[model samples]
Target: MRFSASEGLRTMLTAALVVLLLRWGPQQLVELSRVWGEWSAPQQATAVTYVLVVYVLLRSGRGVQRRVSWHLSAPSATALRAGSALASAAMPSAGGSLSLERRARHEAAHVVGFLASGVVVEEVDVRVRPDGSEGRVVAVDNKGLAPVEQAWGYLVGAVAGNVQDLRDGVHDGGSAVDMNTAQSQVWRVISCGVRPAGYDGPLTADALFEGARARAGEVLEQHRSAHEAVAARLVEYAESDSRVPLSGKDFDDLGVGRVPADV
Candidate 1:
């Protein structure tokens, strides 16, 4: 019956907003009559408080309902529910096996989508500034890329690759990167450049992982078959590598030439 911190905050904010509008409505009308253009501070504060109270009551009710449903269902189907929940919870730690498999699928999706839509998921390049303090550096180029569905594929791939690298003891030369870093970096860039149709605002890595998490949940809940397919394929891909981390070099080993010509 407890609301999550995020949910609670949202509820409070929503209520505050409702209060603001309510309080402001009358004052705004009065201002119009008086040929004034501003709402009094008290009016604004009252409106916000009213909004916040309403929001909390509604949201808290929903949270209570969900908790009740989960508790009731747990006893009836504990094993299945617990198993699935465990897998979803442990997804962040899936390791080289899970990482490699997801990367392959994501890459394939990117390649396929790009061929049909002129959108790319990954970009690679080598850069040099001869006169600068540092020598030439190889960089994964994601610049000029517009955030799109393809970007999600790339974000998944980057995170998976980095995760696999870490699990297999591969070094990034400087500081070792983690799944969180990859997700954040990739998504932040995408949010800025891709500008997917309706999504707006400064994006964070948390948002990227959340999107994937939600998709995974949907597959498990609404399309078990599809979920199984993805899980099986990921497991298979991981096993194929003997638990080794797949990398830029791995692609060359598999005879997938360097970055695509257009890229």
Candidate 2:
């Protein structure tokens, strides 16, 4: 099976640790025997407790992370949510004057995620400061989307897009807000602000994202081609749109608020 560098290093370290302990364990036991009478009962208990704590951390640390995701800041859930929460809002402005390329790509990913027939392209109007900073504001346009598309097809596409946004060599990361409307809510219910299933920890932003991105294999294995087909269509649509071009749109449109790709 294909394994990551981290996994290989982990295995190597574990084996080395085992060997070290094997070599040192007997020597330590002999040393302990030499001092058994000198170590107090409380001191022995403390040593045992430390070993137990370390063991628990080693074995169940992952479980703790997965289970405690709700306690983590919403921004740390994954790159999808981090960018979406900012860019998809009703008013998406950056903390500072943002790059035109970053802005273009951010809009591109969401349009791809939520793309459908007859959707509205709500232009992202950011009021930049002298220093140039802003946040993201996502959109929800169902004005002409068919009701069925709004409920099902758009739903699948949204999940597909969300999963797609994190693949290797996609958009870097950007603040993209959510519109908080029914159409957007339906998609978010299934895709946004959720932790990766395989990882458990007190998630740092890095770990949460790494875990989410690591799902690329599973996501693509099952849904990659389908999502890519849709994203490709989106890129084609954007290329034709007056709004999309140049700066930094590495990969790359919209209709009425709708369901997902399943439809």
Candidate 3:
């Protein structure tokens, strides 16, 4: 990679300093001090200039390195969302008892959550296996969405799934990964200076998660019709090929819309 002129100078000076220290040890500093006292005025001026230039270059280089490292290590919002989807999909069905219909509804709820939260839904699908069933919704472009909104997007699936289970008189086996991912999103938002409403306590994962969970329920209730429509379509699609993914156009065709302005 190309480096700026200051960085190149800093590298050269750092190498020289290391070599000098390795060869001469602490005595070199004493020797340099003695030489500085004996030097003429012009010589002292030149040496001071060199030291100042080296110091500035080295400090700037450190700042540049820090920025590069941070950029390399920090995960983007899109990556986090995609990872959450993958984790949710890979989680085994609780007790190996979840039905294909339930899996579809779970993923459909996630799709509605994404749409309502202004997240882009690419596609969603479900797979049926003898052991259990799995479902996933592919979403992207959540960069500008509020942390609570993104957290809600991650959480709605579990809340809706549990609600469905309640209606069916079945025990709820919520996805732990979904809750963990939602909490992570909440933490990220708080770190970035966006605090969720009604949370005045010290920041904690559970607190952020509970706040997001409550909001998810509210949003889900508001968009219940859209969620039901998407779930019904997902069930119908499963009749032919359970693995086929439903696209954004398919959701749009089903009349899925954004979350209400007040919400």
**Each prediction's whole-model lDDT (CA):** 0.36, 0.38, 0.59
lDDT of 1 by residue, 1-263 (tens): 44456655654564455445555676555533342223344444544675666767768998999999775443211010001111122323333222334433332322222222223223221111222111010123343544453344344333332332333454432112324433543444454555433334345555656553333222223323332343344345445544332223322222222222222
* Model 3 ranges with Cα > 4 A deviation: 1-75, 80-96, 142-174, 196-204, 242-244
Clashes of each: 13, 59, 0
Best by lDDT: 3
Q: Ten consecutive residues with minimal summed lDDT in candidate 1?
A: 77-86
Deviation (Å) of 113 in candidate 1: 14
Q: lDDT, candidate 1, residue 249?
A: 31
Instruction: Order the candidates by TM-score, highest first.
Output: 3, 2, 1
Model 3 gets an lDDT of 0.59
Could you give candidate 2's per-residue lDDT for residues 144-193 as a string of tens digits?
Answer: 54343333223332333334434423443432332122234343333443
Error of 3 at 199 (Å): 8.4
lDDT of 3 by residue, 163-239 (tens): 44444454444555555555556556556565544445456667656655555566667877877888787777866
Please tell me which model should have the higher TM-score, number 1 or number 2: 2
